[model samples]
Target: MSTVFASPSENGQTSGATGGASTSAASTPRRSAVAAVTNRLASPQTINFVDVPAQEYYSTNVFTKSVMKDRLPKSVYKSLVRTIDSGEKLDPEIADIVASAIKDWAMEKGATHYAHIFYPLTGATAEKHDSFLSPTADGSTLSEFSGKQLCQGEPDGSSFPSGGIRVTSQARGYTIWDVTSPAYILENPNGTTLCIPTAFVSWTGEALDKKTPVLRSMQALNKHAQRVLKVFGHTDGAFVASTAGPEQEYFLIDRNFYYARPDLLNAGRTLFGAKPPKGQEFDDHYFGAIPERVLAFMCEAERELFKLGIPVKTRHNEVAPGQFEVAPVFESANVAADHQQQMMLTLRKIAEKYGMACLLHEKPFAGVNGSGKHVNWSLGSSSQGNLLDPGDTPHDNAKFLVFCAAIIRAVYKHQDLMRAVVASAGNDHRLGANEAPPAIISIFLGDQLTDIFEQIKGGGANSSLPSGTLEVGVDVLPPLPKDAGDRNRTSPFAFTGNRFEFRAVGSNQSISGPLVAMNTIIAESVDFCAGRLEDALANDPDSLNSAVQSLLSEIVGECSAIIFNGDGYSEEWHREAAERGLLNLKTTADALPHLASPENTQMFAKYGVLSARELHSRLETYQEQYCMTVDVEANLAVNIARTMIFPAAIRYQNELASTCANLKVVGFEFDTETLDTVTALVKSLQDGIATLEYAIADDSAVAPEDACRHRCDAVLPSMLSLRETVDKLELIIADDIWPLPTYQEMLFIK
Candidate 1:
């Protein structure tokens, strides 16, 4: 059991973690110093991280003293580096030296305070700020940060969600330094603080933070991957690693509209908006010119990301009107997860500066394309490079084929686990909606590979595809360009050249959860293959190629059910998937329990990815998260329907009645049609609101999980019905009489 805090309720009681009511710099001299650094970067044209020289800045590698230069002795610096990079325990003797060095660096950069930054399972980072002011014996104040302070901090654990792991009375929790993620200085109008990334754990030692499990899972995969590499005679290898490049998609709405919508403010999604008249229908905004405001926000956000060592590589307008995407260059899974958390934080802060609110909620608006994070994954041996990439002669590369077949086998065997990885209350609205991949998990290998596989299964083709490659005078197209394989966007897990893109992951969800599942499952597959090869080599070293071929043949035959190279959104593919026996676990309730299934438990335990207790604990946690989310949304819908929509409709009805009476008294006969429409809509709104209220109350009367399902399937529908009637009222009601912003105003406002 790891001692990390898992949710917000676990640490909410912690004092000084939320930052002392955001103090301004005018109160202290340190604030003035920090402002100078921030002021320089505030100018848009002067901010440039792309050309920032690495020599004078902090390096990504933690084992070097370049980041802590001019602060510590040679011996103390090396000792701290060892503790940070090699997982060595921090020495007490070097504590003062290290602390003094950090304080000096931060002060030089104009920082006056510091905070222990930790991820507390609220799907975001948390920090309780503190000033660096300490009283000296002579009465003068001294800014101090001790070695112990740098390495550890205590945060009250009872307030964060511990999945019933601990009670409020037992609230002691500790934050330990996460040396892998570098500490950075954060500047604010109030003051500057050196934020150190740390892992939060409970007193009882159950894993509490998201990063802990991710780190553990990474270690698990590395061990198994190394074993597999050893079987392939890679003797010099110390590690085999996995990398991820997550393409994040999101929507940006004006902050004014965002503030006006209670649903968006409370739930991070709008539960009551009618579809915009021109919602992505014209196929515009996709890769269109970036809005000036959005462009400025992106520049600042990217600069912050770069300073923090997040390699953001690409940005573009997404499919929907307000939608956008940012893709980072590939990094190790652990670093990638850290960077993602930081990136979201940067986006939130910077978007505010541009008067926009970043919506990470999977379906912020109904009928518009929701967000998703396409996780591009690949594995490589320390000695062997990427095993997924085929060389020039792919047909003859048995190693690459074997690795590819292993992934196919893994995806086939644990398709449920893969589906469960991205299952969430928010994502339920996006999956199988034609914009994203279907709920059914299937691999899409392009046409060229499809043909190659078919040929291999059928004992190789008699006629081959162009035996020799050639150059062309018109070099717009590369000679042969490797096979022009057909692409499949429908499959949840698709092989795209050198890596597999897991497109089923939702944008707002943490990649660590899915990567943990992927790394564990793939490691299991790799272990299985290595075992078979080891035995075969021992039996007959002379027939190595034949053994490899036979192994791949068996894998391909068994895992063929998991492959589909057609449209995922098509009804035909769903039926075909059903016929081929694929599990379509659509909802979180349907998918989460599978994590505790006997087979999944065994597979995870086999590779030491997660113990059965840990797996069961997480399953329970996910179920709870799903239920709580639905319950909150259900409550929000009820409130909006009753308070916002119901009152708005009544006002409109009153206006209509007043107008009708005035016309009748004047002997000018008014149309009864509009009056009748208003009356009927009011009645419908009353009925639908009553229905929603009944469903919400009844759902609360049942088991928590059942209540959640009721909210999704029953309560949600009633809310939508009520919303539909109210929306009709909006279309008919005079613009001056309507209370809330209309869809057109909310969606089109810059």
Candidate 2:
């Protein structure tokens, strides 16, 4: 049987199946998408660049040390600065003075209310606003913001997902200000509000938010890292801290196209999109010229971020069309996490104003590169800067070698924990897809470091590789200094000169969870190393260098299996990893169960990062999230297939039948091939929809793990089957009569 595939035109117009002119009777969505493109193209938009430098407006809205010093008393400023810089406990007496100063500053900025902002388990920021007004006895209002209000807030916790932390009857939760992260003024056209970063906890003192565990992990890491610094004979009474810089990636689509698709709106991804004819195949989009409108939106978003103390430093076009990336300067992990949330918010808000919708979904469109947040992490101190940096002579830099060895051991010991932290419903769609890293966690140490470690494991390393110079072929170009080694983009955890970049984190996920896991695991490794060094030094005080060398050699030999310099996306790597006894958890359901393992529980508990009960609660919550996400997507596929796609296909089928019948009446026999194809596809779609409905309606009581399995094993496959038939119908039906927007229109039109 000969088949005709009704491919869409460049502008989304379809050729009629009956060998006649295309009809425009049912092209509402397509017409709308086209109009949006035309309108945006005709009217170019530009941002009004400010005359002042960005440095002038940097941290203007933030309550930073400079602002506090200018506003508060000298004594109060000293005390607060000590608490912030030295990790000293806050003084209660300074709270009222600071609150008074903050209220005055906010009132001067035309503020009427203040909000205690916290990150909830829903992976979104939550806030509760309270007016800074109190009625006097004489019926007149007085501006009032007390120390108690500044420090704590009460929000109803019953509605938030607690995973058994807070029962229904126990609806009380408290938000305490996290002084480590500075407060900022969120500006609006009508009014401005003071946004204070905080940590949420239940009445029973259990951590009910992501910030608490992150703060605890920071403390644990700081304690052990300080011990290591002291052992290295570098004790300057400076506090050690972990720093992070997260690179965010996302897609931009026209608002009209976004609103027309229910799947994109509800599931944050397209449930039924056929592969477009052109899709990032030429690799021309990576670092290509930025579109005018997208650049404008990025500029305005960066302006907002700069005013709020987020040092957004880089922006560029990504590997996929309509996809882009932005990165900020490094800061403390706690503050960087807060800044990342604000960056996402700013991207979305500015996109709306520019007639677009920012998509942070890991895989919003299929058959293309997805989004990921590469978190650059490191440890540093005021006294000993950048412990991870391997200077010119890495073999002689014993301190740096010891720290690098600790990282390798940590990754080898807690690979499951690293995977568990980044596991989520959205991430499962991106990992091991040839674009992002594989599900198995591995470290990428460049040639220099890898060779040094190999030498150490074999015996001793007395020399290091020299930096080479790249000589350009042309006389006009000058020779440049080459890096010690080439970068490995395929590695999930890669050493990039002075820091490690975790490339497996999802675009839409908060960085706090991954940071917490990393810090806690490293703390364990550092503590173990410090104990060994102390014991060795006690045995032979004069042979300190020999003892350090021996310890590092042992660690390198044990943990060298996780260091890979090859492609992580290769199938051979997957087989080799399994042979090496590494875990390849391919899905959120497969990975989240590791959070409750005995080793993980004991590790977190020993490091004071999380209790067993808290860990269990987190695992349950994540599993439930995965199950619900799959359930929602399955139902949406069934609903759209039945209500929208099937009707369009049937309408076209009737048109084909009517045309054939009229042709027959006129004594002209018509070909039945087009009608037969449509008829068969429609029947298949109906059958697939029925099977999906049955799968969704199973409604049996089961464990969370079992529910996740049911959703993945049964419901997801059924939904895919339905999508296959529906997508096939999309290609065959008349584009004028197709109800949904085509992939070409959504992806290329922008």
Candidate 3:
């Protein structure tokens, strides 16, 4: 029998990896870290991977429809499918039968326990396992599974951030099964456990987790989308769902290097490092040949993901040296969001087996390209196809334009909310950098769509401009392929061929928050479109085409200011965007507060997505998150400077002075330039450390908003200034004396 162990409890952990406390930096770590890394490179961790075809393990661990059909009574199976299809409440009568099938399948797979997995406000998975074995009649223990247990679970909520919805004394929180997301078994060598996706709520029935709002937003979108289909003479009953293909980017560094860097251990980023001699300047890392070890890790990760039914599609080296990206085929927004979390967890776990650490922080290293989750978002039904897809049929094309306008309007009006959802202290470092989209939010409608909208703005689009080909000078090369428009990599939100790629979502963020905003805002826009057309249809009782044209023209014209096909990174665009009244919120402090804006509160309430109180709570929760994140990073900076960098520099100076004194005694000459430079750097490092320490203690703001501003204005800049001094010292200090791992060692050694 395989070893069996239950899943761990939530215990009310904080968000992501940011925290106030961590292991102290070693007083003399360089020699040990370097020796460890050298030995590791000589005899690296071996991946004894046995390759298997994807089909062999695809969804093998999931209690999917096939399993349901085989084990459930035909009547029960069909009934459950119907409810799940319509997003309706599951029938109480069928719960027992469904739970039995799920339990049987899990038991057959050698699972002795099951966990109710839910995404809490902390932006991470929370689960506590329960054994199947239970006390039964006649004083015997029997393995049992029941409908009640499968449906609901109570976990302590007092420890999690509820944004004031649930006080510390109110400890009761409920996790209810989310039927839309399927159940799968998590395989560990020690044991297997049945994992059910669930939505968490407080005892007072407020959303205490990310999944609930996403589900609610889907319903809101569906209701308005059905009206659009009803007017156009299609199946109004068919459910419309937002789909997402979130491309995750991260860095993989040797575990030896990871263990040596206290800042990386605690802050999820290097607080100090000099730029390596050879960086990604050659543009060679992007699409470069994958290292053999990294390839093995990717293959195993994909294999594990395949078993869980995540259709991972792409893998390649990203623009940064140590950074890489993985993307999956599009799936329902809720499932994709769930799978994204699973993907991150799996990557981290697998990296360990290979003696590495996967860094998901948006900017783990300062001078290199940071990671971002580019979410390709669109709306569709299996029956009607993608509403955003511009089909060949003129009628289909017209509907596509209407839907396109809906997106434009949604983004134009709610750009602040879009920025707010992706706000974090970690992400703040990435945005507005050359590698990422700027802090200002704008839409990139490609040439074809932009042309169409331009025509619409002029009254009507008589015809869509064809995607012309580009001709290469070489006769052997094929002619340029048909494409409506060129890609804009720098835009925060850009409409690709069939979907809008939201490029501003930080690598570490949960896609749920962004998906919720996208769904809700688009739903409101669709409703606005439907309402306007409904008015025209009722009054005229004819000429549907004219009404659509008029509606398209108005939406396109009103929302035209948000459509920027130019470069987002340009200074000219920033000035122009400001002239057009677009917000350029450069920091989390400038962005997150918009969540509680009266208009946003009203919108969330109107769509039944979030109550005013719920929205306020989220604002408070994220505000606290932002504050906590900076506090941790700032503290780490101070500790590393005082404990690690300062000591190393002093030791190097003393060693140098001793050597120079001996050289002079022996009638030899030494360059005083080197000594002078080291001495100056040591003095500067101490001064920088003092400035950072004062910034850390200077906070007097009681309001969350003011606290965030203080961090943004005072703490962050102080940290950066100190980093500048520390990084310069890293260049001058002897490598043998430097306390932490260098970028070259971490980025290229693997």
- Residue range 394-462, candidate 3, lDDT tens digits: 233778888888999999999999999999999999999999999999999887788777877887777
Residue-level lDDT of model 2, residues 1-750, one tens digit each, is 211111123224321111122335554665655554554432333334555777888898999999999999999999998877767888889889999999999889888999999998888999999999889999999999988899999997767888898877889999998888999999997999999999998898888898999889888988888877777787786767889999999999877678778899899999998888888999998999988767777878998999999999999999988899999989989999999999999999888766678999999998899999999999888778888989999989988988889989999999998999899878988999999999999999999998899889889897777779997799999889988889999999999999999999999999999999999999999998888888888888776788788999889878888999999999999999998888899988788889889999999999888899888988888889988898889889988898889888999999999999999999999999999999999999999999999999985848888888787788888987998898888888887777776778777775
The regions of model 3 sitting more than 4 angstroms off are 1-28, 41-51, 136-140, 393-396, 473-480, 666-670
In order, what lDDT does every prediction score? 0.74, 0.86, 0.87
Shift of residue 454 alpha carbon in model 2, Å: 0.2
TM-scores vs. true structure, each candidate? 0.86, 0.95, 0.94
After best superposition, candidate 1 residue 93: deviation in angstroms? 9.0
Provide backbone clash counts, one per model: 21, 0, 0
Off by over 4 Å in 1: 1-65, 68-103, 130-133, 141-147, 460-483, 666-669, 700-704
Model 2 misplaced regions, further than 4 Å? 1-25, 41-47, 699-701
Instruction: Arrange candidates, best TM-score first.
Output: 2, 3, 1
C-alpha lDDT (0 to 100) for residue 442 of candidate 2: 98
After best superposition, candidate 1 residue 501: deviation in angstroms?
1.3
State residue 688's C-alpha deviation in candidate 3, in Å: 1.4
